[model samples]
Structures are given as structure tokens and as C-alpha cells.
Target: MADTRPALPPLRDVIARHGLAASKALGQNFLLDEQLLDRIAAIPGPLRDAPAFEVGPGPGGLTRAILRAGAKLVAVERDRRCLPALAELEEAFPGQLRVISGDAMATDAHAEAGDGAHIIANLPYNVGTPLLVGWLSAQWAPLPWWSSLTLMFQMEVAERIVAKAGSDHYGRLAVLSQWRSDAKIAMKVHRSAFTPRPR
Candidate 1:
């Protein structure tokens, strides 16, 4: 049979070549498993030719999966160590992947990814809530600039974001996060899935 997978280096190989260690300071972890990445990519709905943005795409693990799903992805990486690896992904996929080296929290998502792009990210615990809050608070009249957000968070944090109204868990954060968009748990990842499992 002909080799059918996209011609991209394995995540481990890319990490080693680039010395891409998971930095606790930068809130970095690499999920080397592509199967889970693909599943996460699917939660954004049909992305064939659609615009998508990813935050902190270390070594482009989930970035590859998102490109394979046919979404045009723009990924913002804070750690410059991973930029070369992402550059490889950009070359492999051509127009499908764009790397922005900066803080994701500061990105103008719509301006960077065109109007109304979907965001899918396995965010750092520190960045997840605040990024969502920023996006939620964004001023786009008539409708929000982002079409949807599919994010990964610790189970407890996810609960807080989706907490039901009138329930004890509900709070201002939950209301603000879900007010403009309908959020849900797209998938649960195994704790061991991350390169350096969080304690």
C-alpha cells in the first residue's frame, strides 16, 4: 500500500531535534498522541476549508491534526523554541498553517485569522480561563468575531466554565464564558496523555 499519512516528523522526533522541553514556566506540555489530537480537532465541527486558530501549539502536535482535518489553522506560540518545529509544519502543509510567535492572550483572533474563525486549543491552565474571558468580552457588534471555541481544561475548571445556572457551581465566570457561545466538553483526555503530567 502507498504511504498515506502526511509527511511530517513524529512529535517526539521534532521535540528532540528542536530541544522542545515542556516548560512549566511557559505552561507547556506536548500531547504526542495524534489520535487524541484528531479527536479534539473534530469537536470544532466540519472544518474543511474553514478558518481555525490554535493557542500555544508546541511542536505542532495538535496543529498537524487540525491541518489534516482540512482547516486553515493559525497557531500562536509563546515559546520561541517551538517556532522552528511549527515552521516545518507550515512548510509541510503550506497555506494550511500559520505560526504567530507571541502571547495568545494578546492576539486579535479575527484580525489574525480572518473574521469569525473557530478556535481550538489545548490551553495552558493559566491561559485557558483568561483567554476565554478575553474572547468572551470582545466587542463585535451584531455577532461575535469568533464562531466557536473548543478548548481543553482541567475537569474542575471545565466544570466551572460550564456550570449550570441556579446550581452552586454557577458563577459570573460561567455566565460570561457561555453567554455568547454554547460550550461543552468535547472530549476528556487521559492524565497520562501529556508529556509531563500535571500534579
Candidate 2:
């Protein structure tokens, strides 16, 4: 079947068109690089036709890549300013994308994305750690709700997550991240990768 979806505007153009300036209060850093976004979306391996969930999908960059990879995506965005842009994505991808407007911290991701969903996101910096902890400790019947987690965090937090015992960075997050599942830093994103780049 020929893909009839309309061509998407460049990420920067979309941001400008939508007036989406990354909000520091929200810990927003809009990722505009398509190749990079595609790489991040592929971190959990093949997601073809699988269920995928994204948190803090500012401007839907990663959301586009997930859908392009053939996953059915459910994205939760706390920033209403980005919803119009996301709605555009919904039109372009049709049934492939479903977006929820609310705080990811409060959302039951397992309920929204269902069992075995691949949870992937750039993750808003302010709430990333707490959110990861919640998912890691969800106490499911057999396993956690999601099959895998591919998330982006600030370098310090990432280091903490993969830190070894006795290391200064090793602590509760490190234990939780490694206790039940294989955890590793799949990639490192430079400050330049984000708009209004992190300080």
C-alpha cells in the first residue's frame, strides 16, 4: 500500500510555526534531529507493529520516529502548547499515534499502552527519575508492565543509573535500574542536540 501521509515540516519549522520555545520550567529540550530521534527510537530493538509509549513528547520528534518504525504509539504530553503540533502528527500518521494530554507522572502507562509495551522517551528532566522509579517498582504479576525501557536522562542521572556498587553515583536509582533488568547507557546526547540547550 502506498503511504499517503503528508510530508511533515522540518522540526525547527514546526517549532517556529507552533511557537514552541522549550520551557525551562517544564525541563523541555526539544530534540529536532530526525536521524538521532530514529536511533533513540530503535534502542529497544525492533518495535515493528509493537505497542510503544512516550512521555513528554515535546513537538513529537521521537513520536514521529516511533510511528515510522511501525509501532503503535501512545504519547503523553504535559505541555498543552505542543498538542496542536501533536495533532498534526496524528493526522499524518492516522491510526499509528494516540496522544494523551496530561502529566506522565500521574498516568498509568501500563493501562494506556497495555502490556509488553516498549516505553521510550527523551523524558522531561524534572520528573524523569521519579517516573523511572515508579515504572521499575510497579510490582506486576509476572514482570513490569513494559517489555523494555529506553529513556534519556541528564548525564549525571544516566551515570547514576548505570553506576557500580561503591561508586559515588551508585545509589537507589542504580540498584533499581539494575536489580531486575539489564540497564545501560545506549547513547549520549550532547547539549547541542537540544533546543534552548540544557545548562
For this target, which candidate reaches the highest TM-score against the unseen true structure?
A: 2
Please give the clash total of every predicted structure, in order: 0, 0
Candidate 2 per-residue lDDT, tens place, 1-199, comes to: 9975468899999999999999999999888999999999889899988999999999989998998888999999999999999999999988989999999999999999999999999999899999999999997445677899999999999999999999999899999889868999999999999898888
Q: What are the clashing pairs of model 2?
A: none
User: Cα miss at 6, model 1 (Å)?
Assistant: 2.3
Model 2 regions lying over 4 Å from their true place: 1-6, 140-142
* Local distance difference test, each candidate: 0.86, 0.92
Query: Per-residue CA lDDT of candidate 1, range 56-126, in tens?
Result: 99988899989998999999999998899889888888788889999987888879998768898989877
Q: TM-score per candidate, in order?
A: 0.94, 0.95
